[model samples]
Target: MKGRTTAWLRKKAKRGFRGYPIATVAFYGPTGDFATKVVASIFPDEGSDPAAMERWFTQDTDVRTDAEIGEQVIAFVRGHAALSIVVTDGIIGCPHEEGIDYPDGTSCPKCPNWAGRDRWTGERVH
Candidate 1:
């Protein structure tokens, strides 16, 4: 599965991706303790199939050591924020403004208001 996904990513790269996208899963314990983490970042040389990746994530699985912990993490993200996790609790004045679009409609990566940066902390997002 990893190889297949990687190949897809390579294909995408050949086509072109503005930035390398990735997926990370953070697990927690039954009591809601942060347990472990997994990141599928080593993609193939080119591009990837977004739909396939989405299916892989949304599909039911028991790969985690603690199923309950996984469930809790999923629920927390779903309830507290959008599917994209943005840690804003401790950042000053966080929950920063949205990313600004360039005159051509693309996001301005150099903009101070870029969504990828934690406005309050000036920290780079993962």
Candidate 2:
């Protein structure tokens, strides 16, 4: 135990960073090789999964505000044991702008403004 981490562990311990299940960062090892591993406990800020947000924005019709959208997304994600998703375009319908033909919430014969959604994928980028 002359130069072991466990022996050092038994000594006075300094608080380490706290974000568990975090993305692994590469670092040079004692053998001069790059490696990755999760060796500590760090409380995550509950990562913002864009995929989950996409799912919620597509499925749930009750969410309107960006805050509500994000909250519902996190809730839905936490409910599932695991989930994986990918959207081709991160931005959906172009918001009302100069050249875009996106339906403004005003004259939408299909849906409401706050509930403004992409009818195809049902993702509200507007």
Candidate 3:
């Protein structure tokens, strides 16, 4: 497989192409326990454009140190067939940051620090 360029991936991510099927990817341990998860959107391949698809895969897929773990994710996705199209790749997920509320899990409104606006921007937190 050819190497994935971080610069290309970053560019796609900036454009907001998350993960395939537009869902969260939760990785699991060998014992079938939860390990970590990414909330990236996957970008589908462009017709007759293998290069575009390859770029998307390089951007969306996580570069796991453990080959086994990586394979497991592929198997899981294939088994579930949770794909909208032939998923190549794109942005994997956003990095977890403090004071930033992701759309998943707890909503910003319910958070204790929620003051009807974003703490940093003073805009509506929602």
Candidate 4:
């Protein structure tokens, strides 16, 4: 049940671009090893930005393995009647938002592990 929801979402994403109303899913955390937050957005069409977005957070559990959170994510996508789903394969970055959570040019004080590292690859950056 833990991995099942994640698998289902991934399966939907693997179906490729079916049509309009695409759902995008991304995970974030303090470190690349554990996802503490998940953000899901719905794009109505190719040229349009996301019309709807939702975020879930967990401090003690990984959002990837949280059954309830996964269910909510599935429901959100379905509720939007999304024809396509795109999910990130790994944690992309910190859960905090730049400019909103911290200054734009400064590293997130709450997520030092992600500082000076590539968000997608989690590799140290020069």
Candidate 5:
């Protein structure tokens, strides 16, 4: 069941845009290979910012495959009555927020693996 919840979530997302109260799911980690953090944001309506945002983190396991975390994420989206769910296909970037976790102009000190890498493609950038 490690991947069951993730599969379910992705399946839901594949249904396409249904309506308002959309939930966006994104994963982050030190490197693009393993997701240590997951962020879920809820938008109550179109052209509006997320009204609620929640984050889950794991130190010893990938959050993507963690059954408990996956359940919680599913529950959170359901609780918000989200009509649409959008999940990122893969890890997007470092788990650390640049301005919040480190100096805005500098790379994350804790995640050198993501430095100079494109978050979307995971490719080295010039």
Candidate 6:
């Protein structure tokens, strides 16, 4: 997988994504232990097939389909600041997991489908 990603990065370079895109995941367990951690995830993969992405669920930190996930995580960690509960967060890529051309099956990227359906729940992302 790493080798495949390296080759993919080279391809992205030609497309003008010269550097690695930033991606991070934060989570607050049901127990309320707030934490935030940065990750080098979400590479520029040319193929975004579900079969290929299914494997990524293990190696990559999956961001649940929630807007402002990063801000929520940060709030959980910092408790109270001047910002208060006005937490705000956004993924490095406003829209993630793009550029897969599939005919029979759905795409694996986390963003909304081209038709505006939720990739996970099949609901409208908008």
Give a tens-digit lDDT track for model 1, residues 1-126: 124432332343355433333322322111122222222222222365432121112223322434444444444333432223222112232111225323443434433343455434546674
State the lDDT of candidate 2 residue by residue for 31-102, as single tens digits.
111111111222233564322222222222212223444343334433432222121212222222223334
Worst ten-residue run, lDDT, model 2? 29-38
Q: TM per model?
A: 0.21, 0.22, 0.25, 0.96, 0.95, 0.17
What is the C-alpha local distance difference test score of candidate 6? 0.29
Number of the top lDDT candidate: 4
Off by over 4 Å in 6: 1-96, 99-106, 109-116, 119-121, 124-126
Better of 4 and 5 by lDDT: 4
lDDT of 3: 0.33
Displacement of residue 51 (Cα, Å) in model 4 is 0.4
Residue 92 of model 5 has an lDDT of 95
Candidate 5 has an lDDT of 0.91
Ranking by lDDT: 4, 5, 3, 1, 6, 2
Would you give me the overall lDDT of model 2? 0.28
Residues 54-103, candidate 3: write the lDDT tens digits.
11122233443334444544444444433432323322222333356445
Tell me the number of clashing residue pairs for each predicted model.
13, 5, 13, 0, 0, 0
* lDDT values for all models: 0.31, 0.28, 0.33, 0.92, 0.91, 0.29
- Could you give the candidate ranking by TM-score, starting with the highest? 4, 5, 3, 2, 1, 6
Which stretches in model 2 have alpha-carbon errors above 4 Å? 1-65, 91-108, 111-126
RMSD in order of candidates = 14.6, 19.9, 12.3, 1.1, 1.2, 16.0
Clashing pairs in 5: none
Residue pairs with clashing backbones, model 2: 18-42, 18-43, 19-42, 19-43, 20-42
Q: Is candidate 1 or candidate 2 better by lDDT?
A: 1
Per-residue lDDT for 1-126 in model 6, tens only? 124432332343345433322122322111112112222223233343211111112213333322244344333323321111111132222132234433335433432333454333435665
